[model samples]
Target: MTQEPKGILIVDDDQDMRELLERRLRRWDLDVVSAENGVDALEVLEREGIQLMITDWMMPEMDGLELCRAIRSRAFSRYIYIILLTGKAERHELVEGIEAGADDFIVKPFKKEELHVRIRAGMRMIQFERQKETAIQALRKKNLELEQAGATIRAHLEAAGKLQQAMLPLDVEHLGGVHFESLFVPCEYVAGDMFNYFELSDTKIAFFLLDVAGHGVPAAMQSVTISKVMNPLTLRARKAPTESSGEVKTRLLNFQDPAELAASLNRMFMGPKTGTQYFTMIYGVIDTEKNRVQFVQAGHPSLILLKSDGELKAIGEGGYPIGLLPKATYFAIELDVAPGDRIFIHSDGITDCRDANRKSFGFERLHEILSAKRQCSMRETLETIHRELISWTESATLEDDLSIVAMEFK
Candidate 1:
């Protein structure tokens, strides 16, 4: 269906002039309406929704200038273009008409061609305004939709963050005779860093801290997958053939050696499907009965050992990041730990964390803090480290995922 052209209203005190203008406008195929005075013209405008008007400047009761002022004062749904037909041609008269809100003017005995061109200009302005209004409405609708989508994504990310937090160690602070404490912070709602500690046997316990490459959803998902794979129950589900029976049997093979656990993880994750994804990890097992700490470092930061005699040692020489090399070999280091000795394992996010000056909170600072807090309990020491890190960066939020696990021999 085609939309009808807008009607034009003509107001004049001269009956003959009104009819003559109407005839000429109708001959040009314009939808024209006429009134003998401004008061009646207002009624026609309200009733017919006319957007263009032509009026004689002088009249009884009310005139063209008064009509323009009245229309400008009212809050109409659309803009109204007013053209004044005036006998006065002085500059001051034109300025007075403009101040009264007339959009254009035509002098006495005006040419019909000039009148038609002025009407066309008014129609073009109305069309432009309509197009601009439509574009604004469309942009508002799109902005509303984007806001809704952004809200949904944030909700999902928050739920995923809660699930990841639940996977961390619970209230098992004291397992066997060793006390444990930890801290975890992610740059986003979900973290690429993960850590956990669980008992392997009555006298043996396992713990690990791994940081997947990158941040956000992809890295967080991979971290969660690796955490599931590290579960003792899942590890035990993988059976191997026994040499004596030549039959498949469930064994805690990976749990016995931290190096083998790292190697198994590398083999499981290495492939084109994983792309350039890899992770740095420190996997360790503590034997309560033997008072020994055995661990494997796969491209992770060195483990800090604060001895009972107040001596500090930084262990590990760095190894290949897991899943990066098919033939990468991991070696486990065994150390004798005495009562009151403490071991700290962390992701590189800690030492690599930068301050406002772009200076890293390096190994020297970390070692100094550990030595100074030697007399504090495991939890206190970890808390102190966390506070210092936040202060050093001068921000409540970190640039990368930060994770730390501390253990004290009893």
Candidate 2:
């Protein structure tokens, strides 16, 4: 990645002087390009890759200062090193030459070694200029490559995200006298945030949201596994028992039931704690026949119940986070769903969020959002919360994952 030596343009009207200077410089490995006057020197600059320029200040048509000014007017001229040869040795004359882009100068009747020193200094300047230009170009190339890679990866993730969304039961009719809704939003890092809902059986309808601990392709793959395991089981279960969501609520108002699904999840993923990895999830069976909602909470946030009359309740006894300890039990919580009530189930990313000041939005803030917007539709309430969440992080870049799901019972 090296270029030929910086072409030294020797501008002198005397042919003998030009040959002598050229011969002296050619003794070194430096490239030398000759011109008789400033006019010819400017042409050499346009036509040749001149890195170190040496011009006589007394040249006709364009003096050394004028040539320097013209060179300075161009972009990237800083990369070129210039040396002015002056007959006047006065201090002011030397200063004038320096101001006119002379990186170094030599007086008339100067020794060969003196000229050598001036050229050597100019060579060092050229070397520095070459290095800086090389570094800048390298950096620009890396940045462009990174941008392209990001675009490609984002497109693929977005496609996978759309597929994940389509896999959800988007229009499940309100069963068991319960209204259902679900939401998922990926932070820049796509993680194992997957959700599923379906009729588990004729008497019981099932719904669950699962969030894996990490992000990117690994989390996305885990999400696929969760979907494959749950969706089919849910579809088959619908053939068996029968119950309206209203019946499920009635039992929860009374007592608890060990959802068989909890044992299934705990068995499949929650193993020995040696890097025992799993996810947090909340699965609820809406038993329309019993009028109760039986659910399992595995290290997740408490479900928020927003009543139509403007009251908000945090449902579920928060349980141990999944995959933390080996064989940790993820138990189910029971809640009664009265008429005209709404329940919100979400990831901790919502309330545990922080701002620039590192302050948590917290459980209390979430409750307030729900209480204030109790009368709004589930969609509107979710939007309001999202808007506030964004505003909260305005002073800082987005730091974590966020999601909110609202379920209303009419």
lDDT of each: 0.87, 0.71
Candidate 1 regions with alpha-carbon error over 4 angstroms: 1-5, 9-20, 33-50, 53-109, 238-253, 271-273
lDDT of 1 at 407: 88
lDDT of 1 by residue, 1-410 (tens): 22434689999999989898999899889988889888998888788778889999999889989999999998888789899999999999999999999999989898899988998898887777777767888899999999999899999999999999998996339899988888888889999999989899999999999999999999999999888888766767763222236553444457878998787777667756456479999999999999998999999999889999999999999988998987799999999999999999998888999999999999999999899989877777777887888999999898899889988888
Q: Residue 21, candidate 1: how far off, in angstroms?
A: 4.0
Q: Candidate 2 — number of clashing residue pairs?
A: 29
TM-score of 2: 0.83
**Least lDDT summed over 10 consecutive residues: which range in candidate 2?**
248-257
Runs in model 2 deviating more than 4 A are: 1-6, 26-32, 76-78, 171-173, 215-217, 233-259, 271-276, 307-311, 395-398
- What lDDT score goes with residue 410 in model 1? 85
